[model samples]
Target chain A: MEMKFPMKKFIFYKRRTANFVMLSLSLLAALITIVPLVFIFYYTISKGISNLNIDFFTKLPTPVGETGGGMVNAIVGTIILIAIGGGIGIPVGIMSGTYLSEFGKNKFGILVRFFTDVLSGIPSIVVGVVAYTLVVIPMKHFSALAGGIALAILMIPTITRTTEEMIKLVPQSYREAGLALGIPKWKITVMIVLKTAWKGIATGILLGLSRAAGETAPLLFTSLGNRFWSTDIFQPIASLTVYIYQYSTAPFKDWNDQAWTAALALILLISVLSLVFRIITRSKYKA
Target chain B: MVVNEQVNITTEKTKSPHIAGSSLKISVKELSVFFGKTKVLSDININIFERKVLAIIGPSGCGKSTFLRSLNRMNEEVGGNFTGKIIFDDEDIMKLDPVYLRRRIGMVFQKPNPFPTMSIANNVVAGLRMNGFRDKKKLKEIVETSLRQAALWDEVKDILHESGANISGGQQQRLCIARTIAMQPEVILMDEPASALDPISTAKIEELIFELKKKYTIIIVTHNMQQASRVSDYTAFFYMGKLIEMDKTIKIFTDPELKQTEDYISGRFG
Candidate 1:
């Protein structure tokens, strides 16, 4: 018996409608997520553009009611803190990641991974409290060094996780190819596996840096805040996030305006660093 | 049919004692592989002579490639339990350091998987450098010679500094072969080296295999019977994890001793 043409036509129409609905829903979800990012950029530039100038970068923070103070101290402090934090974090993170991916098939490795995951989930405020006890109280003062250590602790788990994931993404075939050539296992991991995943590892490092750049709660109790330029890492240092937090709650109107400018500066710095890292990594594969 | 008759005559003549007394380079005895309690291959016994090409032919899941991998301890990477005695140059390979053993017996995989990050010349000399050869001049010589031997030097000579991935598919396979040969291994194991290539590239590989057999002992696992007949001196037919028959290549193709061998060669089953 031959089927009627109208029945076949109806079936085709139903399938096409189902596909259209799925595509439309996906598009809607994508737009919904992008809306917040667009708004954040628009608000930041519009509110902070008038005050963006060299003076805002070069001058120091003033008294609560005065204007014309720049964020030079905060900028320098942020640089020193990040440098110290990354110095402590990157090596340990890379080693831990290598241990987890290369030797983690055993019981000890499992414990290390468990601890790292736990550390990653701990709140920034908790890290601040811990740093206050371990570093601030023992040293008898709030110092930039203490804040850097706290941020390093936060950065380690992120770098380790990213490095482990990148290492795992390297194909086993590359390792076999290296081994078959009589290369030692360590050389294969370092020269072949690591080189292949270098881009991913870079991405991971940038992500960790971006995360550490905006942290405020940990620095509040450890580094506290400074009103003038301070190069000594052992002394209390001002950072952009902490400055914004401190100024936004003050009684003076000018301090609040300066807080908005500091916030804008931090956002710009992070975005530029991320963009540069991305460009550098992408160029590696382009050639 | 006429070609078969001529091949049979030549094979019978070559089976005489005078031709069968060549020196053995590799010998496997009671070699079996098990993947976590599941036995994949039974006892595999074979003697591979120097400067000869031996082809392993079988259906899928027949453990031919498994046997080939065991010769160089390539199976060690699979994380399985294996019991075997593979002797290369009178030394038990399983008892030796796998890294050292692999240096003497290199392998080429089915797919052409060159290191994506390295230049063509670097890929060729990677094995040499890995084994602690630091002399730049000598490394360059080996790279050039190996690529020339693999028939890739003329095409890639000018662009030796280019990424290996920039080459065509056939050239990449030859580059892999060149990389393996650069190790100066005495024995080379190929796991369906030509299966992924086009007809022209397949012919080039076959010709290269023939030329290479003069300097190295080769054991190849191939699904293409024509390739086995064209290139091999000895052929081993495997079925269901057991070796069914092994003889001179012509005998395996023309007048196999077992019914199953004849059925397989005739394309009745795999």
Candidate 2:
């Protein structure tokens, strides 16, 4: 009896230990996926913080070997590109998303969803090539407009997918409540569904914006680069990603420092945008 | 009880054409609803009179809510095939534009679903705004009156500009009631309006229903037999997609003509 009691207790301890081991392993796997993002943030901030200064944002980019310019031109170019790209992308993406969520249970909606998925998975380089053939070649020059169009193409799929998913999350009860009150179907979609899913949709657009902001590959063949400040949308303009890429590869310490600074600025801008969006969504939830 | 009195008045009026003939706000005939190949609700006939409360009582899946939804053509939004005639205020509701028909017959849901982003005043006046009402003064008046009618005026008057979602769940449900009233709809369909609320809130809603009967025709669907007994003048018992028995509330509960209704009321079966 004493031996049997000890044996049972030992088995219980062994089972508990095995369970804890399995739990820890699963947790480690999760952490493995999250650790890279942490590393990226740590690496970028530590490397770039010393070079961050007002001059990095207020002055123009220096030539290959020179040292006294900033990323002022790149900053302006990024803003212009994002604004025009968003302008081109938001309306079309929102409409398609609405179609998929509200009217897409049929064959046509399925077809649209299939194409959207395909568009979303296409390589950014492929988009650059397409934009080169369509906008840059047609205009007979490298231009900010071509870059914006390429970014817009990248943005559409993200926006559409997010919008569709967000709209789908809205409870059917809300739609039924609106319809029961005699509201028109289109009115329900706009006033009720859109309003209910606005935060999610906004977050989706921000995600698309962030993706476009960080892209260096697409603008490589399209926007090229400019040394001086340029406001013309139809002409080539320097952006932060392109500036970072160009300066980081050059053989000068100052140019390399400026690249780090530009990268830091880009990171800070996207983080602030995401933080503001999170606050808005959080307040909505509390309300 | 109020239910017995209302039934007597309804039957007497229907026979003599003196009391309820002019008050018949909605007349439904041979209504059937199908979701895809499966029929959800069979033929239902009901006459809703003005300034009276009609309660639809049944177990789950008895088509009570389905029948209630048919009043405002809410079923149309569910992608179902509906066959029947619903006449409201001398117009065939099916023949009328759904938007226009919905304007005249408002509905409240089981759950409190105030638009989270809108203010209390905005929620009350959503229907009016949808129909292009823009005058601030007129809107203010309607909002106040509707709130009063919903018995939510005092609780919400001080914070009308606060977000609708900032209020309590019960208050949100009352806000929905105010919203429907602001439309000035002739008929109001409520689908278990108090089901999600606490008992106190349910009582308040029941009291409000009594008050609302003075101005609008009310049709309510509920699983609570006591609630049907307390507020309604007429009771309709639905079973398995068909309306089994409809009579004065007291008679339906105490002296039901159908065994199924008797069994349901006695709690022997749902």
Candidate 3:
């Protein structure tokens, strides 16, 4: 095929067409990825916003067939479990991470790293089973402690890996400077390395907590879900995910509707937590 | 301790011509450094004088920084291991606690690395606090004195509470120097300390080095031959982990005995 126009103009037109086609394809890919996420938000808001009320935050659940039910206990219970999980997991994860990045040339560091990797790759439900065996069976009953432990186990691997990576981002010169000043190694690790990497570490902690908060299967095997309000941690407790799991599967129309609202509540809780972390990280004294 | 000092004085007077006039602060004996399995500095013997500026000039990768770091045992942090003895003012280097040794032989790195989380004032006195100096008045005094010594107090005194990273690169490097000096070290080692700065900052750092040598024994490593000639009383030329020539700075620049040293000085090749 011979072109009447100059070859330079023909090449330029072809190049422009190719650019347009590739750009459109990339935009279409982004659209396809975002559409599902948008649909999820739209579906949840449409189904659950009408069900949301002041009562939803304040009141306890009604019996299975009853109409006036709220997830106040489940919400409160979720907070307690997350608090417990984070309390145990954060310190362990951070210390292990410190070992990996700072003193990790040895065999023990490699062993710890391998175990953390394996733990993170393990299924969430398998962790639930381990928690069930270690805590639930030993106590002869399901308890909130067991549920908290399960979530903590799942959180450790993510927090450890992220902390290690974040600490690595701190320059090697900072450590050298501290050492040259005759500061103790432990003091340098805690004061210099940890402080410099704290913001990144906090992000890792938040991600781990958010991931644990939405987990259902881990809580299912350990806490075993309670319909009524319970305050004692030694006793079985209701959680948002467990409540949603149960309520969504129930035959009653009102119960299924409550699941939608419960999911929306969980999403809101994670979002608020993330927003709080973001603000704290971006504050004036960020260093 | 008194007898040991007398013996060091006699040995310093008789055996070493290069360090005859000035009293010795540190003596290196057959020191060799290795990073993992690879040797970086080998079979080195040198005498560093008290209250004098010594410069180590070499091309990149010649292990100048490694030799400087070994004086304070800072090389251990970077996977470099060494064999042999370093004597600091008559005490064997291996016997002295590393943490304590570093307090008396502080170091300044090539890059300006201030603790990001600390204020300028806090960065200066970090070492003092680590050694159990808790008096706020004393800490304030040390910060002022050290910052003045580094020629940074006038620029940073008003904003002592600001983050260390908030300062300019030159200021940050001076802040690192002030931080090291606040420890009250007897000797200061600088590893190409002005390599990352602009020419003006480099000049300022060189001036600071001249001022610093009156109170502290200083060992500096430099890539720029002019810098070595300007600020150093003694110059040691290293090539490929070996000290090729060691002499007075003027003699090394004007009348180096080795051909390699002459070539490097004349810009024939690195």
Write model 1 residue lDDT over B1-270, tens digit each, in one string: 123332334334223111254566776676779988888888776767778899999999999888887877777677755786777777888678988888988998888878887889889998777667899999899889999999999999999988888998899999999999999898899999999999999999999999999999999999999999999998999999887788889988998888999999999988
What does candidate 2's lDDT look like per residue over B105-222, in tens digits? 8899999988776788988998788767899999999999999999999999999988888988899999999999898888888999999999999999999999998888889999
Error of 1 at B34 (Å): 2.1
Docking class of 3: medium
Q: Whole-model Cα lDDT per candidate?
A: 0.85, 0.84, 0.88
lDDT of 3 by residue, A33-79 (tens): 99999998998888888889988988899986778768898998998
The CAPRI class of candidate 1 is acceptable
For model 3, give the TM-score of chain B.
0.93
Q: Per-residue CA lDDT of candidate 3, range B22-76, in tens?
A: 7778888778999989999987777788889999998899989889989998788
Higher-lDDT candidate among 1 and 2? Answer: 1
Q: For model 1, state the Cα shift of residue A202 in Å.
A: 1.6
Residue A8, candidate 2: alpha-carbon lDDT: 54
TM-scores for every candidate against the unseen true structure = 0.91, 0.90, 0.93
lDDT of candidate model 1 versus the reference: 0.85
What's chain A's TM-score in each predicted model? 0.92, 0.90, 0.93
